[model samples]
Target: MKKYLLLTNEELKRTAKPYLIVVAVLMLLEFILTAAITKMHEGKIETFMRENGVSMQEAIDAYGKSSFAQVVASGPFLLILGAGMMVILISAFVIWYRDWFGKTNYIYRLLLLPGSRSSIYFAKLTTIVLLMFGFVAIQWLMFFVLAPLHDLLLPPELFERVSIAAVLERSGLMYLYDFYLPNFALIYLFALLLIVFIFTLVLIERSYRKGKKVIRIFLQFVILGAVYGATLLVINSDHLFANEKGMLFLAFTFLYLAFLVIIGLRTVSKKITV
Candidate 1:
């Protein structure tokens, strides 16, 4: 148990370091740019108010309908945050592939580790999940850092304080937070299912040596398509049967996650290769 934990922790650290650096740098840049832009807009508004002899509230009401107001409301922070998310999503594939295709071929050593081979799979899965939550934690922390900075730099009337929750709620991405945070168990199960499915596909490709590569790829697509179809059916059934969609979705997700984990373990134990 100790060895398994050590291996998992080591892999988590190795995988997380680069991502942490990138995320930190990107977030810092975003914060600086957002503050600069907010200050620029505030200065313009203040100037226009002074020149026109308009009161603060009057100036706000006049500019509030303009596109500049929208930009200030959303901020440059969301744009940079979206870009960081894209990098993190791409890192998912990189994390899995590097173990197999890196110069050292770490997967070979990983397979020879003590105890069950499925530990390697679990370790990789754990690393990905940890990195994901690490990103979330950083984003949460950014609200604290950026919110006060905005307040200090700009007048309260010029810049409304937006909480992390408020930003998410205002954006179209509110569902992401709602789905993952409040209903974490269901979301985590769904995430595990996705990870196991991707791991299974990686194993499928590795199991094949030279020939039938096209066939294996086609098989993967067909399998994934079927799974998607079945999942859609389960989701649709809730509306059709007039039942509670959340409960039904959770039950279906739990079962699907179990099935994927079983298949992933079997693939790793019996068919995976270096």
Candidate 2:
């Protein structure tokens, strides 16, 4: 337990600087987006009033007031969403490469530690999951701030009342950052399963010779393809198991998750070499 905690702390320390920068930058950009989008919305209302010679209330009634939901649908927000997801997925993969990339051969030292390699594996996985949750928590809080800021920027008559929940619900942001317990739990499990799969694939292929490396890579993709294919097959087969396909699929995913973790632990402990 002590070793695992210590290794987890080291992993967090490795990622702290860039991780904090991404959080801070995301917060600042979100603030700017809220203000800029609201101002543009305000300007649109003014233009409507000017062209039609109507009052603010009339313009709003005619043009429909803007809300945080609209801001999320804007191109800038979608771009940020895409970029943030890319950063997250890249970070997940890069956490492994960081130790392997340089001349230090850090993985050798880690593997040689006087303990089960599972400690190292769990520590890295825990660190990545923690960092991801931290980012999500901070972003969740930012939405509260941004929602009110959005409301305050526009004239009351030109602003459609919107709470954080309403904004997320209406904009479909909930799909990306769903806070509901069951939904979030499922997403978290899928994320864990994915990270484990990626870790296993890298371990199996990382040090292989080029000829064998290609084969290993092909095998990794084949596993991935099989998972996806099985999912599609089960999900679309409505007649299977009297419409209990959801439970069946969950069972299949759980089994696959266990398989990946088992293979990963074994590969790290016995197979991989410096």
Candidate 3:
């Protein structure tokens, strides 16, 4: 257990360092740009109101209906943040692949550890999950930090305060987080299932080499297709099951996760090559 924890911590540090640096740089840029652009738009509105002899409320109402207003409301700064997230998602696969295929062949050392082979799988999985939550925590903290900074830099009336929840809602991430803060369990489960599926595929490829590679790849597709077909059958039978489709889907996903995890562990322990 201690060794597993140590391995996980080491992997987390190795995987997170570069990713965190990129995330931090992008986050800082987004913060500065969001604040600068928002303040600029507010200043333009104020100048227009002063020049036209219109009231502050009237100026605000007019600007609110403009294209610039939409941009400000949606916050283009999030685009950089979103791109960073996509990079992290792709890195998840790279993290696993590089261990096996890198110059060091780290997977050979990892497999030779005096513990269960599943520990390697779990350690990498934990590293990825930790990085994901770390990103989310940083994003949440940024919202709080940027909100107050904006308030201090801009006038109270011009700066409309938006909470992290509101920003996430607008960005469509809240739905993934299940719209409510406490629903993070759903997010965790969904993320775990995805990671498990990916790991299963990785194991399948690792378990075979040149001779039967095409057949092994075909078998993987067949397995995946069967899982998908089963899921669809459950979903389409919603009417027969009294419209409990959501529950049925969740149950099916959990069952598939278990099946994949078992297969992945077996392959990693017995068939995977260094």
Full-model lDDT for every candidate: 0.69, 0.80, 0.72
TM-score of each: 0.81, 0.90, 0.81
- lDDT order of candidates, top first: 2, 3, 1
- Candidate 1 — which pairs collide? none
lDDT of 1: 0.69
Better of 2 and 3 by TM-score: 2
Model 3, 84-201: lDDT tens per residue? Answer: 6676676667777998777788887888889798888888778877777777777767766766766666665565666656666666667444645435655667777777777777
- Candidate 2 lDDT by residue in tens digits, 137-256: 887788888888898997677777777777777767776577666567667788778778778777777657778878987887898789879887877875777437756667777888
Scored against the true structure, residue 246 in model 2 reaches a CA lDDT of 57
Residue 167 of model 3: what lDDT?
Answer: 60
Runs of candidate 3 with Cα error greater than 4 angstroms are 43-56, 65-75, 176-182, 210-226, 236-243
Please name the candidate that would achieve the greatest TM-score relative to the true structure.
2
Native-structure RMSD, model 3? 3.6
